[model samples]
Target: MDPALSLDSRVATLSLAGMALAWSVGLTILSIAATGAWEPRVWAVALLATATIVVARETAPLRAPFTAQAHLVVHVLACTAYLLYTNGSEGSAASRWLPWIPIALSLLIVAMCRYRPPREILGAGLLSTSAIALATMPLVAAPMPLHGAPGGALVLTAVLPVMTASVAAACYSRILVANSERWKAQAGYSSAALEPALLSDIERVMYRERVNALSGEAFPFLRRVLDADSISAADRDTARDIAARIRSAMVHEVDRTWLQAAVDSGPTGVHAPVVDDPDACAPMMSGTQRAALRTLISSLGASPRLDRFTISIRATDGTCRGEVWARFRAPYRPPRRRRNADLAVLRVAFSEVTVSTPADQLIVRFSFDHA
Candidate 1:
């Protein structure tokens, strides 16, 4: 699957999971409120169930599929007990009013789940409000010993909304912070992966320019091909094909720019093919070849100027033998004696960095003697 598509799927799944959790909690709370009264034990259990669910909203117990589902089950069971204790009647004033507290509390949990609030804040809010909501029940319900206490009206009207909304705000704030962290991580990965490849390509081009700076001729059509203006598909294909062919043509020339482009365009990541074929060149290469290859690719991949240029190294007998191919972008000149000197040094380092270009294909090969 495409990376972008995979990311979209994950986002959708998280959203659905969050919504389902909220709905389940809300329904349980409503069911409890519809009951008129309940036995002392049953009421206790019902309050416990609500507390369990609300507190676990984003915690390990709540986030895990099995644990969350179990909490919801408990919520429903407690609500059922509340209804049974009340004799299945919904009209009683005590019953009609009791539902408001749990419902509001549940709504707060739902909101936090959807928004993915901070774990610490969510836990604290759930625990604190559950304490308040459960306490309010006896004050409003019958059976004076455990009922008709104090502050029943205030708990229902003012406190519930305020507490729930506070939880919601905390949840929203947490979500934003989490998202910001993810963005920073992604940005770091992109930089570490792509920058090196770009810099590697650029360094190779610069090295070649240094050698040939005295005198060289630039390719005529290179600039037009790289220009950003819109063009037909066919033209684009044609341009790519031509550049590819040019890259192929220069394979025997041992040009740094062309080789750099080839390596940079292949793949990007902290872990990637840095020196083209380090293994193939290993056996013949001295420390210098390895160092040069690493430096060359790193500089080119990080640099904009070398991105469009091509670099090719063809090796024979584990050393640079025949040709080094480089296709410079248009308006960039090739150096005069630079070519000869590069060829000679590459030949001298033949065992370490041999360049070879066969009739039709260009290959960079290295080998390191493990023994």
Candidate 2:
């Protein structure tokens, strides 16, 4: 899977988990208001159901099918309980509509469709239909005559909308899955088609840079060697040394503009510290990774108390490791929320990142594969 798409899935999963938690809280509040008493069992069930769904969402990548199945089962059971309780209670004909509330909440299944298979969506729809039918069975069997309306009318009125929505959602799920697959196929094709052009452009740039560098370093020496009437042994040795140096420099040539920009743009009050490894070449980083590093530097610069900061980077064997260390004039403490948000952005780009604060110095270390 594409890393961007995988990150999006994680974000969606977290959003759904948050929605489930909010729904559970709302249900609990409604129950308490309607009954004028706290129901521990209801609260326990609600929390457990929400927590189970959240855990399943968090672990969905491990076993998507099983997670979807578990989510469907939990939703069905929870909605069934709500339906049964509301239907069994004594209330006006208007109360027949109350059971549909839980059924409506089941629409969250639509969101799940994005990540679940067609079979799972179908199974969920079927199970939901059955559960709704079973919940309304009492009304079907009892045939209560209220406000000149038949019990069958009440059951149908309540069930039809839920069933229709479930079916529509199922169909929509298929469409969504098809569209997603198509989009992914097109993305793959586009990437494949552009690879050669991108590589050609990179090769051209590197070639140009190398040519410029060679001219700048060796042109003077070459001109002198040619201008001299008779080149001495020392001059020949000097030419050889110059050639060796140029080759060595070319082997490690890399752009250092990003590093300079990062340092120069440090917070207004903070002293701009030098790169830890002044001679080390900048690692080739993706746009996403560079953006992440930019954000990290900005965050470090944001703290008013930070008086000094240093950035260190090392690349070896197709991997690059970087560290940022900041020192504050006063006893500085980082805010957890802000720190976490910054780290989240880094983690999206880098393979691994860690932060530590020992005393007043804040240190962040991250690594990524340059290859």
Candidate 3:
């Protein structure tokens, strides 16, 4: 979507989906009231509820990679089936409000699109609405010749308003995302500057990032000095400052261990589960422990399905304790075989290893001497 979705943002998404469910339910009740048919109206309510549950799971802090797409499938099935089932011979009169039914269901499609990617929004909306429209077309025109019959062709007409609105709204969102990316790219000094991938997970520090900042200042200062007629006292002071900072930065980099570099920026830029090591415990782990943790962190980070990650290293008594928590973007646990190798590394690397996976969340606790 807009790319910067934190867990807090999911609350807002769930709220909107909840409201859509409420409104959809209201429509079901109204359809029943209008036609006095109990069973079909009941089915409509049930379908909407089922769709709502799927939506909740998808919008949760954790869900499968297919969860978002599952919304499209479940909703299309529920909404289309409800609209088609009701607008038939048995309940033609009751479904007189069928036009509004399609629109209401379509609103659900639009509502859930917030959690989906911008590029896919329009296609999801169009395809879902089209499925509803097509399903109704075959039966709508021939629903036992009831008065003011809701015809097949008329179903498309009924859905047109929502369809148009969804398209416009989806396009607007796409444009907003495109513009946001453009603005970020323009403002940044390099690709790394604009993209979060460039950020190092370890202490949120990167030598390259620091060098970029340093160079930003150093290069400009050098150019100014070269263009000037003569070097002033301040110019000489500025040059001395840059030289001192450069030397200090080099010395600091030289002192850092290999583990620091490994965690700071390795493959996949050691992606994005928030690293919360406030105790500064990583640098204290033994060399082998660091290697094991590094491998596991990298492997987990490499998965596109990664949702949330937290690594906490604490110092207590004579030893240092470490915990790594990871949650994937799947509704259930990913296959064990995929992680079996990384697990083996963990078992071999640490003296005391404990691992548990509850739901999709993985927690691994280990201890190593502070080196």
Best-fitting candidate, measured by lDDT?
Answer: 3
Candidate 3 weakest lDDT stretch, 10 residues = 1-10
Off by over 4 Å in 3: 2-12, 34-36, 64-68, 87-95, 143-153, 187-371
For 320-346, candidate 3 gives per-residue lDDT tens digits of 787888887768685554665566556
Candidate 3 C-alpha RMSD relative to the actual structure: 16.1
What ordering of candidates by lDDT runs from best to worst? Answer: 3, 2, 1
TM-score of each: 0.25, 0.52, 0.50
Q: Quick one: ranking by TM-score, best first? A: 2, 3, 1
Clashing pairs in 2: none
How many pairs of residues in model 3 come into backbone collision? Answer: 3
lDDT of model 3, residue 353 = 64
- Residue 179, model 2: lDDT of 80
* lDDT of candidate 1 over 125-199, digit per residue (tens): 555455555544544454441233244663565246536654775666576667767897998899889998989
Candidate 1 Cα RMSD (Å): 22.2
State residue 135's C-alpha deviation in candidate 2, in Å.
5.1
